[model samples]
Target: YSHHLKQGGAYKCSASNIRWEVTRETHIEYKTTLWEDHLTHQQRNSWIIAGLLWEITANSEDITAIHLPHFIDYQALNDLDPPLIQIANFKDGSVSLEPASKVHPTRVVFENPKFSLLGVIICLLPCIRPIPVKGLVMVYHSQEAADVTLHVYIIPDDPAMQEAIKLKEKGSRHIMKPPVVRSMYFGHDYLLKSPCKQVEIKPKQGVEFCYVRSGQTINFYEVYSKNVNENITLWLHAMNSETCLWEAEVRPGDLSSHGDQTEADSQYDLINREHRRNLIKHINVMQPICSNLLDYNIITDEEKEAILSHPTASEKKR
Candidate 1:
């Protein structure tokens, strides 16, 4: 089954200046340069304008109710078989997607005025048994601009993800940590919450410690301790009950616990990090390219050198 999935074609992010492709393994691949450059000037303008409008309406907070009746029709522009991304802004400050034929309708309506829909990226891969219709919608509110929103719609990725979305639609609340989260560092502030009333993080080696106080605020009892290690556990002390809250393993430097980096891993991380920066820049500035932006190179000379200089594949695996 894995071998069959490996042969699946790529899922595309066609609207991006850089062509992004996701393999069946979920590894994202990018073309070195803009694929839309080949597009006619008028066509390219449509892409840019659509992306720009998406960046604006999605980020607006406290939107004047008067301006909510507008709907930008992007389907008329790009000639892609399946539209890259399509959005509609309704009078109620709600949004909807005009799906391709036979595809499910996607909507972004906010019940809470504090949240606003930003943008959506839909990923679909053909030939896979359980077709993974997974993508992220950029969401934000006027008050908290820095925090990330996790309202995922995993249509067919995993049964659990699909079930969670179903339960949510029925007015049930479910929360879980993301698969890839930012690493925790000494003295750095983080928003921590415990299912139980109390939660603590003690160092496996040293005297460094942190915990959740009366509120959800995380209190770092010891910062910059030299004894941070590869192994650490979060102890959730129950409050108002006898059962423990939750327990999970965590590492000091690596949030995802990717472990020691190899040459390929380092190179991939560097590129991936820059890709994320590009996405953020696009959202903030609404410019596809600017003088201050990093150069778009699929693989740099320095990176190639590092890959070549690394120990043989066998040794690196050891």
Candidate 2:
């Protein structure tokens, strides 16, 4: 997967370097690759066959909140007079990342929703058998949802569907939510809120894509240094969850010509030497970049200026 990422062509950002623009192309490539590599055909089949039930369980109590979009007729649903929604025909299904994480993948389900709408009209018009469906759903989490818009019409005789039905027959609990589009648009906030910044550009200029999250960033840098190579490093933080004290080091591909270290490093050293030593020990074993945010109470505008001044700033032209 990392290999393909290096092979994938780079998207030169002709636009201004907004947070979204800086990491847009890279996020898309990383997500598409993860869908292809991390998940298997059988796992996807299990989700389509069995996971849908997990999405629609009625008695589940974990729903924190619900918001019905204006498009949905709230009164109609409340009155049990809702408009007929097409039952999704599970012709095919695949796993797609709604959000990038090991657990996030389990919460997503994608199915074609066209057959239910068309099956009703088939008697009026002589439509071909097994019409290819559109609006492939990408992800929908059950626990976070109060009501679902889609219902599955499990095609009889399908081994996978049959298994799902048997489980249903046994009174297995399941859950459902409104179908979401397969993979959010690349510009969406899901990708833009990455904990790791787009710190550097690959100068050799082949292609690059990256997946950054709380703990690590799987960065793919395709350089013209002979053949394409994968320079992946794990990002580590001193604190769990969101904190100003987290640190990361410069990766091999992200090194700047200005210098090997940044101005923030001196500041980071002053915050806590004991913690820094322990962090460095873990970092040496992990090979992660120790970042410059260790000492700051909050990342103020002035501090942001100092941080951005590092070659790590993506807005700076390489």
Candidate 3:
């Protein structure tokens, strides 16, 4: 029995026929430029697909729930039961709270706390999905004297809020004290006690004072006696941690011993003597003479003739 011939495209053909068809057919080859364009387009499409997939995956993992804490300003501190110094949103999706009293109990409260929005933004880069913040706390410390006041600032870190605390501790460590001046005067040696603790004496000048210490009379004297007193001024000074009190005493009509004319005259005389000695020494060094020409009596002849008529034959040839 003969099998019915299946007449379709060569699907039922043998492997040889399929191979022959693949080899014989004019295989269309892609040009290099066209192939490059195609590859670029495919790559672009693949990137777009990958980007979409990544976005979808990220959205699935991203945190949609977030609890933002209330931001406190300087004015809010007065009404709040607990003074809030700083508030921070951490990287592990956690929030940290800091109290002003805990940070720096001695620090004065800020009337208007300013937030560093840019600083917060820069510091929160690591925790991008959730908002993270770094906060600053300010406290006020009244100055010992009403004229001066101190403000202490604090920053929150993993380590306890110790910036302001350290500052307060340091401030308390060194108590402010009124300045005391202790000085002695010359000629009459005595300890002079005054609100002014330090005294300045000029050259060729002296001050006298007396003080009683430990049931004994103490005399002090600061005798600034110098022959040349260019800078002489009595300075009443007070010593403090920051600065020392000072004054400049410029006494007019105080002339130096050597006048300008006398100095100029002395300098000129010395210079003239030096110049004269130099001239005499130069003349002495140039004392060597033309002994041969002099022996030939060339010096007696005047001008051109003397040089022309020399003693030696070589001189005559010249």
Against the correct fold, how does model 3 do in TM-score? 0.14
RMSD of 3: 41.0
Q: What TM-score do all the candidates reach, one by one?
A: 0.20, 0.13, 0.14
Best by lDDT: 1
Which runs of model 3 end up more than 4 angstroms from their true locations?
1-130, 134-136, 145-148, 157-164, 167-169, 172-318
lDDT of 2 by residue, 1-318 (tens): 011111122222111100111211122111111222233555433221111111121111222211111111122223221112211222235322221111111121122111110111011022222221111111111222222211122121112233434343332222222322122111112110123333222322221211121233322221121111222221221122232211222233332221223345555777766664444333321211322342233322223333333453233345
**Which tens-of-lDDT digit does each residue in 4-120 have in candidate 3?**
211211111121111001112121111111112222343332211100000001111122211111222233234334422332212233223223222122122211112111001
Q: Considering lDDT, where higher is better, how would the candidates rank from best to worst? A: 1, 3, 2
Cα-based lDDT for every prediction: 0.27, 0.22, 0.24
Better model by TM-score, 1 or 3? Answer: 1
Question: How well does model 1 score by local distance difference test?
Answer: 0.27
Scanning candidate 3 in windows of ten residues, the lowest lDDT window is 48-57
Number of residue pairs clashing in candidate 3, backbone atoms closer than 3 angstroms, sequence gap of 3 or more or interchain: 12
TM-score ranking of the models: 1, 3, 2
